[model samples]
Target: MTTMPAPRRLLTIAVLLALTGLVATGCVRFPAPESPPPTATAGPPVLPGVQVDVPVEPLPSSEACNATLTLRPPAQMPLPRQMPPNSTMAGILERGRLIVGLDIGSNLFSFRDPITGDIQGFDVDIAHEIAGAIFGDDRRVEFQVLSSAQRIDALRDMTVDVVIKTMSITCDRLRDISFSAPYYVASQRILSFRNSNVTGPAQLADKRVCAARGTTSIGRIQAIQPRATIVSTTTWADCLVLMQQGQIDAATTDDAILAGLAAQDPWLRVVGPSLGEEFYGVGIPKGQDDMIRFVNGVLERIRATGRWQEIRDRWLSILDSGYGAPQPYYRD
Candidate 1:
């Protein structure tokens, strides 16, 4: 290779560098320097519109119609395959399956089994009993996943024959749907990090507590602890994630649900006294007197025959929840 003198080599390098700069500015434009990629230093995940300015929804008056008083069951309940002609049970039988609305994420109540992919829980068994009463086979039930807000609408639009989600019986809900006699009575409570020192409502002051929107828990918590800031989540699991991420201080819902959340993470715990009773029922369409009576019959039978106790023991006992089946109440 021929070697150039130092001055000549330096001049050649300068000319090449100048030519490269001119080419970059005049030809390809170098992609306009990339503009830093529209990035942000994110701290935690959150759903949009989750924060809320607590509204004044005073708790529904306790006197708002005996919330648990549902239509009384028939004196002579019909056997499977013997549904009355043109009745709700007959229609369900004709369809060959009972369509149920529930949440798959509601662990211990109706979550999918990790091994088998089947949904089984306390509420699920109650629904199974209804299917057995109508079709002579408990397996003759189809579950449709739904959110808490969609339960009533599902029944109203005939999208589901029943909603076995952990729904509460309240006067406000009673106006929209007829409930089967109270099957499980839950109480609103709080869930927080085990070491968070948030043991009860007293510690909730100024804390951003989360609950699912369109749930009775919101009004109950708001009414009980006006000092705490409340945020709305679309689902209970969202509240759990928010707490896990340290985005929220605590979560409030029925003890049954809080138990499920606590079971998922060892670092979480359920705390506080019951805010109030929340009676869960098999939500039926309003004006479906026969269906309401029939479902109430199923609930009554299960409560008396020890089946309800079996379900309670199987799913909730592991959570240290020894709750008994809620007693039935009849409007008649």
Candidate 2:
């Protein structure tokens, strides 16, 4: 079976460049301060020797909950072939392109295809579907790379019209933003070196486990084993780096992400049953019912037209798990 490969050596070089006053494309790095940076106004202090001027905001996520609880029904709307005048769809049309926020380091979900140098993956296709629905062209999109911590803030601040990243739908997040119907289902899992004795998350007790910042996987790891020291990085690629270097015993996150990481290193393997479920949704600003409805319409078309399965087969079905379209749930 063909496996997806994220260039680990290139990624390591990018990290090194970031530390040495250069940041490669698609990777995020904080600036180094000549002197001790000012005191943090919020969240935790910067890790020793890591100079980050940005404040890390706290975003709460569910621990082990399934996604069925917060599923909201999408509104009925015409196919997005043309803009509905005076509506959110119309506003997006007037702007000439769909603005989407996502992470470029998540291998299978969204990442730069090393050979083509264009960001492409399952999430990228989802964005393309939305763009195609609106402008009759899937290429009419501007992808803004963002870190995991910036997902909600990007939506709330309207920096991105929609967020197609692998974001989970939760009641906690609903308070701040709206979500489309669940498009993909993901479950938390553990990734470790192939020869490691670790069989599952439970075995990682008292060991180090890594997850992306502002993600639910971290909380799930804590619930699985409180003694396990949790490590947070800016991206999943970073987690894979820590695992490669033996800095952490295991990396835990959605199986979708772990598969991509394992593809990069044949020596890595994912162990254990699912920790819990995650239902992915496209995030829209709070109160933007039209935008939510529009996004759902796009998802509905993808599911019904077999496009969803096609995308999965192309990018994700290579993983050990098979693919099936998620049933759309409407709260109304």
Q: What is the C-alpha RMSD of each candidate to the true structure, in Å?
A: 6.3, 19.1
The digit string of per-residue lDDT tens for model 1 on 223-282 reads: 778988898877788888888888889999988899999999999999988788788888
Error at 25, model 1, angstroms: 40
lDDT value for model 2: 0.80
Model 1 bad stretches (over 4 Å): 1-39, 48-51, 319-322
- What are the lDDT figures for the candidates, one per model? 0.85, 0.80
Q: How far is 2's C-alpha from truth in model 2 (Å)?
A: 83
Show pairs that collide, candidate 2: 73-330, 73-331
lDDT of 2 by residue, 32-108 (tens): 87898788676433332221222232433543344333334345555555677788878888899999999998998
Winning candidate number (TM-score): 1
Query: How well does each candidate superpose onto the true structure, as a TM-score?
Result: 0.85, 0.79
lDDT at position 150, candidate 1: 86
